[model samples]
Target: MVTLTPLEAELLEVAGSVPDPELPVLTLRELGVLRAVHVRDADAVEVELTPTYTGCPAVEAMSQDIERALHAHGVRKVTVRTVLTPAWSTDDISAEGRRKLREFGIAPPRTRSASEPVSLTLGPTRTHPSEAPADAPIRCPHCGSADTELLSRFSSTACKALRRCLACREPFDHFKEL
Candidate 1:
């Protein structure tokens, strides 16, 4: 593991504190997108960022926000670089972030068991009377009921799916497990 200098560590904290443009409830740190901050010069720094997906529209906004944040923190030159080598997964989100999401009425993404990738299975056009995929049940964030059905594959954003609970009859967005 790389050991961060005191300055680099401080800058990381500053950059990570920027709230996500789309999801204002969570910071970039909590979302796990702020990858690393490298000190390039006394007044310059480089920040690595990983997006939720390859063509994520929020990435540019995130970069600009990071740049502005670092600049306001006294950095003259801030380079926000997009790194996709490792790619990003919902699993990167912190437990606290997940709880915040649930409280925000959005179902947090389900975590995978290991390094294995999580598979996506399309539900039927209508509600599937029973929760067949027992493993990854999309529970209602509002009512904590597992009897939820997908209303749309894409919700407010591509990363989330619209779902409704049979128990509470409430609609919510489920962060699709990456």
Candidate 2:
């Protein structure tokens, strides 16, 4: 296992707990946005972050939150860096995050191999065909029923899809895996 200095460990704790602006219910660590935390000195620290998607509006907010969190934790100097290489994947999201998403009335992304093709549509007005796997079932978060249908390709957020449960007859969001 890797060892961390006292300050480094504390910095990690503080940075990891920064809540995502878009999904306030989950932390940056839970959302898998916090990539790394490196202590440059006793008074300075550097944090790396990866966005859920390119051009995600929450990136700047998340970076600001991280810096704020670190400063509040007594770090005199904090540098927040955005890393785009290797990209961000829903697979990086923690299991706890997935559970929390479900509890928040949002269906978590389905686990699929990297080879599986994802059909996603971008833009505010654009729409895509229902990409929900026909074979892989989707259980409703509100009613816990397998009977659900994709209402639209987009939800309130770009990372989610609109869905409705047939059993409960309620609309909810599904966190799409990218």
135 Cα displacement, candidate 2 (Å): 4.3
91-133 per-residue lDDT for model 2 (tens digits):
8899999999999999998887768776667645422224544
**Which consecutive 10 residues in model 2 have the weakest lDDT in total?**
123-132
Candidate 1 Cα outliers beyond 4 Å, as residue runs: 120-131
What Cα-based lDDT does every candidate model obtain?
A: 0.90, 0.85
User: What's the lDDT for residue 12 in model 1?
Assistant: 97
Residues 34-135, candidate 1: write the lDDT tens digits. 999999989989999999999999999999999999999999999999999788989899998999999999999988767685666775444543745666
Model 1 scores worst on lDDT over the 10 consecutive residues at 123-132
Candidate that scores best on lDDT: 1
